[model samples]
Target: MTNTQLIFKKRPIGVPDANTWSIEKNPIPEPKEGEVLIQQHYVSLDPAMRGWMNEGKSYIEPIKIDDVMRAGSIGKVIKANNHPKYKVGDCLTGWGGVQQYVATTAENWYKVDDTLAPMPMYLGTLGMPGMTAYFGILEVGKIKSGDTVLISGAAGAVGSVVGQIAKLKGCTVVGIAGGKDKCDYMINELGFDDAIDYKSENVMLALRTKCPKGIDVFFDNVGGDILDAALVHLRMHARVVICGAISQYNATTRVKGPSNYLSLLVNRATMQGMVVLDYAKDYGNAAAEMGKWLAEGKLKSKEDVYEGIENFQSTYNRLFTGEKNGKLVLKVL
Candidate 1:
């Protein structure tokens, strides 16, 4: 059998294009001692993948040229080489990269029951994006009941979860998304109190109108102007969770900083960046609680899945184009 892989080729100055990656088919190899070969089913397509393509000192090392593109994946163990924690037929999820088959040790990969949720859902709400929202809002944002929570990119994966969790905690939630459809999804489907259609509305004026009391917590995913607008509406002692800056991910120039940052000093608010890996130890407990909420219908999980490994480049474009709703997943099997 052949293992198809997406290889990172040239780094781009702005948005990645067809030249950024190349696909190759190589012979599937056997697993060495203490390793297992996984037949990957789905790979996660996230905004963070954009950052991973750049050469810089960030949360994690950048992907090297000629290497298989890095991504979170869910798959079944088809062959095991004396691995203690995992066996053949076990479903596992981890950084399996962009490949049809992966041979690796059972270090970071975690066994998951596909019965609890679909494999794609695990890559969405039950996985990294879910974990990000859980920690970024609760731990970093320090949200409390009665607080007004504002989220940018509020219709996307992490932001959508942030809005729902804030609502469940008794906070009034406002979401900022690009189009009318996404805005409506947040208000009608996700139970957000209000949503700003950034594509058509003046975000600053809209924030003033929707958040009349000012915002107590801001969970930011799309940074840039929307972040500056949210900063201007901070109430006293407000907390800003900087989970991501999707707006500037593909920019050619330096990332735009919030010009209304002085609002932080004036309102005595705090802005902090959050990395989900920091809360790794508590993932099991958080996932259990979230799973329970999912079972009870208090939380919702959405995944926009596309098929075929060869379609990766086109599918990945949806992340920046805002073409897909909710968490984006790619089916490689």
Candidate 2:
């Protein structure tokens, strides 16, 4: 059988488009010693993928020319060789890229059970999104009960989880999203105390009205002006978790820095950035907790799935455009 792989056609100069990728078919490979052959099902489409495509200094190296486009995926084991840890028919999560099949060592992959959760959850909340929210809050943000927490990009995958988790911790959570629907989702569905539509509302004014106690924790996902707005409202000893800068990801010009950083000094607050990879050793702990929350229905994950490997590039485009409402995944199966 032939495996279809989406290869990087060229490095993107700015926002990526269809020209950045090319698809080709090749014979599927047999698993080598201690390796497994997987037939991929779902592929994660993340905003961070844009950073990984650019050549620059980062936590990880950029994807090389002509290489298979990098991604996280959930797949089923079709064949296994010399590895007792994984067997045929076992579902696993790993770097499956934008491909129909994958042949790699089983060590990097984690076994997943669809019976416990859907395949998309393995690519979403139970996967990187959950880990990102878990570690970015408790480990980086250091949230405390009764603290007023504000989150940017509140309706997206990571932001939604962050706001809900903050609420679960007994904090007054406010979310900043793009529209009334998302704001409604935050307030009515996710249990956020308040939400501000950045496109239609004054961010600082909304924060002032909602967070009468001031902001004790800021979980930032879109880190441009929204971050600046949150900075001005920080309470004493506030903790700011810099999870991502989605607003500036597609800029053709130089990325802008936060100008209101002086709030840290005035409020005696702390701002820290964290990469989810930094906590890879403890992913199991976080995943288990998130899974428990999910199983109990205390947490929910929203996924926006687009089908086909050929649609990968276009589907990724939706993330930057703010058209995607949740964890973006490409259905390769």
Candidate 3:
């Protein structure tokens, strides 16, 4: 059998295009001892993938040219060679990259119960994005009841969950999204108290109107202008969780910093960047609590799934173009 893979061809300057990745097929190899072969069913498409493409000193290593594109994936183990923890038919999720099949050791790979949620959901709420929201809001943002929580990219994966968790904790949640539809989704579907349609509204004015009491916690995913606007609306002792900066991910120029950061000093607020990997030790406990909330209907999860590995480039473009909703997932098998 042949394994289809997307190879990293070039480091993108701005938005990645067709030239960024080259599709190739390679022979499926037999697993070595202590290794397992996974047939990936779905791979996660996240905004962070853009950062991984760049040569930089960051959280993770840059994807080298000619290597398979790195991604979080969920798959079933089809073959195991003396693997102690995993066996054939076991469903696993980890850094399986963008491939039809992967052979790897057990380290860093997690076994997820597909029965609890679909495989794609594992790549969404029950996985990295969910973990990001859980820790970013609770630990980094230090949110409390009665706080006004504002989230940029509020309709996307991590932001959506952050808003819901804030609501469940008795905070008034306001979401900022690009379009009317996404804004509506945050309010009507995700139970956000209010939403700002950044595409049509004056974001600064809208922030002033929606967050009349000032924001006590800001969970930022889309940075750039929206981040500056949110910073200007901070209440005393507010906490800003820098979960992502999707707005500047594809920029050819240097990424912009919040221009109105003086508001942080004036309000005595704190802004900190959070990396989910820092909270790795507590993932099981967090996922358990999030799972309970999901079961009780206190939380919601959404995944926007697209088909085919060949369609990867176009599907990934949706992250920046605001074309897809919620957590973006690619069905590989």
lDDT winner: 1
lDDT of 3 by residue, 50-162 (tens): 99999979998999999999999999999999999999999999999999999999699889899988999889899999999999999998888999999998899899999
Model 1 per-residue lDDT tens digits across residues 134-159: 99999998888999999998898899
Better of 2 and 3 by lDDT: 3
Error of 3 at 124 (Å): 0.5
Task: Mark the regions of model 3 whose C-alpha exceeds 4 Å error after superposition.
Answer: none
Which lDDT values do the candidates have, in the order given? 0.94, 0.89, 0.93
Off by over 4 Å in 1: none
Error of 2 at 150 (Å): 0.5
Pairs that collide in candidate 2 are none
List all candidate RMSDs to the true structure. Answer: 0.7, 1.1, 0.8
What's the lDDT of the predicted structure labeled candidate 1?
0.94
Q: Of the candidates numbered 1 and 3, which has the greater lDDT value?
A: 1
